[model samples]
Target: MNTFGLVIGLITLAVIGIGAFWVIRGERVLGYLWWPYFIGAGVLLMVTSGFIKNDWCSALAGVIGASLVWGATEFKEQAIRAELGWYPFGNHKKRPPFAKIIQKWKPPNL
Candidate 1:
């Protein structure tokens, strides 16, 4: 019986779980303004995965990349949750560089 698909699926599930956890923590500590950087990193990982020679490695990289993209889209909502008192609000969150520029653009949602 082939277990490749099963293994990959489990790995993906794990990655997604970790992604959700990080989205909350990241937003609280780093703030949602870093969404653009997350998107760029995710896209870069996905693009770089195409050049991998090992199938397992490529699949894992793709899963992680997709999770990052999903988490990035959730950052704005995460921030809202904190503001609404649903999540712990960080008093001294790190400000993203170019904060003024980022505020002018709409953050991604999914």
Candidate 2:
């Protein structure tokens, strides 16, 4: 019986749960402007995972990367939720570099 698939699925599930928390917390602390950075890092991790030889390591990296990507997309929605009083809103969010430029671009949605 191959338990590899089961283990990977569980890990992915856990990452997804964590993703939700981070999306809320991250948007509050870091702001939605950080979405581009999250997507970049997630894609970097996913591409790096291809070079990993160990099956478990590679799978874990890929799962985490995917979660980050998903979380990036959620940042915009999370920000809206915060504005709507659904979540805690932070008055001082850390802005990313090139804030002016990033503000001109629309954030990606799922």
Candidate 3:
């Protein structure tokens, strides 16, 4: 019933879609830590939802928060793609220092 939640969810989906497109095209503009940052922001938003006065506002906040948490997972998958050489490692010929940790967890063929 809350239109605001619907709007926020749609916008979140669009942003996630664009991010996925960028990753699929080998663009790593957001970097590895973006996921954790997004997840943190999402958690903050969800916590703020508890204090919101309007029902629609709270719903919107919660929806956006969930979407951001999901986005964080997508970011990790993007990192995996980058490690597998399916995606470029941004501006570096070598993986960035942040990627070194992820590289250690990469599977042999992937």
Q: CA lDDT of each candidate?
A: 0.94, 0.94, 0.64
Quick one: ranking by lDDT, best first?
A: 1, 2, 3
Clashing pairs in 1: none
lDDT by residue (1-102, candidate 3, tens digit) is: 658657767876776676557444433765655445566778999999999999767877776776666666666667677878876766543344456565
* Weakest ten-residue segment in model 3 by summed lDDT: 101-110
Off by over 4 Å in 3: 1-27, 82-89, 92-110
Number of the predicted model whose lDDT against the real structure is largest: 1
Give the lowest summed-lDDT range of ten residues in model 2.
Answer: 59-68
Tens-digit per-residue lDDT, 1-110, candidate 2 = 99999989998999999999999999999999999899999999999999999999998999899889999999998999999999999899998999899999999998
Q: Tens digit of lDDT per residue, candidate 1, span 1-110? A: 99999999999999999999999999999999999999999999998999999999999988899889999999999999999999999889898899999999999997
Off by over 4 Å in 1: none
